[model samples]
Target: MITELALRRPDDWHLHLRDGAMLQGVLPETARHFARAIIMPNLVPPVVTGADAAAYRGRILAALPAGMTFEPLMTLYLTEGTDPADLRAAAASGLVKAVKLYPAGATTNSHSGVRDFDKVRGVLDTMAEIGLPLCVHGEVTDPAVDIFDREAVFIDRVLDPIRRATPGLRVVMEHITTSQGADYVRSADRDLAATITTHHLIINRNHLLVGGIRPHYYCLPVAKREEHRLALRAAATSGDPRFFLGTDSAPHVDPLKECACGCAGCFTATNTMSLLAHVFEQENALDQLESFTSLNGPAYYRLPMNEARIRLVKGDAPVSFPDKIQTGAGPVTVFDPGFPVFWQVAQD
Candidate 1:
């Protein structure tokens, strides 16, 4: 059996590092393993302008601890009133890697998201012309649609239409949670891809609901049935270039996550590499691990691969990670994979 493996450093295609205390506390968790990450723009006011992205990037760099290196690939939040000229300039200067599309009320802090697609057609055109990809949170907020079926519905009703309308617009469907999502990506020919979350690859809805309400398991585009999980596993382990790692490692404090109106997010940044190793091993496709976590993301975004490499070692005993990490705000729980994880990243 393979005991140790090394590969090029990985990049997170999707990530959430909230500003202020939370940002300072959680930024290292991801930077520790990932060389860079496509930072989510869904903040309190949102990163909507070139200046906003530049300032946010500076703040991220400022928060990063010394003796550690990590690059923040910034993004702009799409809104009806977004300025095409500003977005074009941001992309030209490489200050923004992509534009995020969150359908209004789709997930946490998404009230400022776009409600009318027509309004952003001009911005989309500018992006296509300049070769900037759009990172999308793919779930329709229609109350009538079943929560579980929202992803599939969004593909047919929203995603498909937008793609067809803007032929050259590149889109990365973020944290796809269903077979429908995987199939949709497979069916597409060009300028399309999807990001699979580390947590989704391990836990299904049962893990979230079987015993009691596991608030930590709750996340946007909530975990689906076991079959969907299996499908995602197959796609991820298949070495499909179109599918890559985007650990939407959203973190909310214990108080915010355990209360009556608990938030929807899974804090997986801390143990993502370990969990990915566990899942890939279970699929008997450990060889594909590098492609999923490291290689594929940069290729899709047209960026160069990282020169640094990380090594993972599998041992007889299970790895132990902190149950919760204490930040200035409060304690934030780590994602529990339920089963033992024997594989962990070897310390440098």
Candidate 2:
């Protein structure tokens, strides 16, 4: 049996590092393993402009611990009032890596997202011309749609239509949860791709509702049925460059997660590498881990791969990770994969 594995250092294509205290506490968890990350633009006020992304990048750099090194690939949050000229300039500056699109009311801090697709046509056109990719939250906020059906419906209604209208515009269907999503991306041309999250690959809807309500297991575009989970596992391990790692490792305080009106997110940054090793091992696709976690993301974004490498070791005993991360805000629960994880990243 193989006891150790080493691969090129990975990049997180989608990650959420909220501002202030929360950011400080969780930044180290991801930075410890990932060489760089496409930092989400969904902060309270949101990173909506070139200036905003540049400033946010500075803050992320400042928050880095003394000895640790990590790069923040910034993004702009799209809104109805987004300016095409400004977006072009941001792309030209080469500081912003992509632009994020959140359908209005789709998830946390998304009230300012776009409601009318037509409103952003000019911006999308500009992005295509500049070779900038758009990372999208693939769900519609329409109340009548069943929560479980939102992702599939969005593909049929919102995503497909936009792609059809905007030629050459690259899109990433973020945190895709259904087989429909997987099939759509598989059928699309090279300009499209999808990101699979760690939790979505491990937990299904049943895990969230089996005996009682498990709030920490809950997340926006919540985990789908067992077959959908199986599909995601297949896609991630298929050695396909279009499918790569994007933990979407969002953090919410314990109270915010366990309360009546709990927020939607999962804190997986602390143990993502270990979890991915476990999953890939289970799939018998350990050889493909590097492409999924490290190589594919940079290739998709047209950036150079990291020169650094990370090593994972599997031991006879199950590895132990922190149950919760404590921040000034409160304790944020780490995602419980509900299975013993024996693989761990060897420390430097």
Candidate 3:
């Protein structure tokens, strides 16, 4: 059995490091293990224009502790009012790596998202022409569509049609939660992929709804049935480049989470790598862990893979992780994988 494994440092293709104090508190959790991450732009006002992205990038760099090295790959939030020329300039300057599409009211801080897809045609067309990928929150906000079935419905009604309408447009279906999603990604021959979150691979709806409400396990594109969880595990550990890791490690303070109307997210930034090592080990696919966590994301985004390496060492005893990450915003809970994990990132 492999007890020590080293690979290229991973990158998070999707992450949420919210503004100010919250950003200061959680940035290090990811920086410790990851060399870079595609930072989510769903801030209160949202990171919309080239200038907005640049300013947000500056704040991220400013927040980085002096000794630690981490890069925040910025992205523009796509809106019905998005300016095509402004997006073009952002992409050309390399200040933005991708554009995010949130169907208005889809999830947290998405009120400024796109309600009319046609209104953003020029932006989409420019993105396709320039080869800037679109990172999507793959769920519809229709009141009629059941929450669990939204992803599947979005694929057939929204994503497929958008891809067809704009050929050469690359899309990353962020945090997919269904078998239909996995199968759809496999069926595509080009310019399409999906990101499987660490929590999604471990928990299903039963893990959320059964026994009682476990708020920390709750996330948008909320965990599905056991079969779907199994499907995600297979796709992630299958060594398929089209599927890769994007923790979607969104953080919401305790008060916001424990209230009558709770926010949707799981703060896994602090324990993602450890959890991933445990999951891959269970599948007997330790050989493929690096590919899922490190290689595939950069390949999809056309960025060079990191030269730095991280070693995962499995010890005789269970590794302990912090229960909550204290932030100026409040205490953010870390995701619990339910069982003990022996593997952890080696400091050496």
Clashes of each: 0, 0, 0
Q: After superposition, how far is residue 305 of candidate 1 from its true place, in Å?
A: 0.3
What overall lDDT goes with each candidate model?
0.95, 0.94, 0.94
RMSD, candidate 3, Å: 0.6
Candidate 3 has an lDDT of: 0.94
For model 3, the superposed segments whose C-alpha errors exceed 4 Å read none
| Candidate 3 local lDDT, 173-275, one digit each (tens) | 9999999999999999999999999999899999888998988888998999999999999999999999999999999998888888899999998989989
Residue-level lDDT tens digits of model 1 in 226-262: 9999999999999999999999999999999998989
Model 1 stretches with alpha carbons more than 4 Å out: none
Estimate the TM-score for candidate 2: 0.99
| TM-score (all chains, Cα) for each model | 0.99, 0.99, 0.99
A best-first ranking of the candidates according to their lDDT comes to 1, 3, 2
In the range 1-348, model 2's lDDT, one tens digit per residue, is 778999999999999999888889999999999999999999889999999999999989898999998999999999999999889888898989999999999999999999999999999999988889999999988999999999999999999999889999999999999999999999987799999999999999999999999999999889999999999999999999999999999999998899899999999999999999999999999999999999989999999999999999999999999999998677999999998999999987
lDDT of 2: 0.94
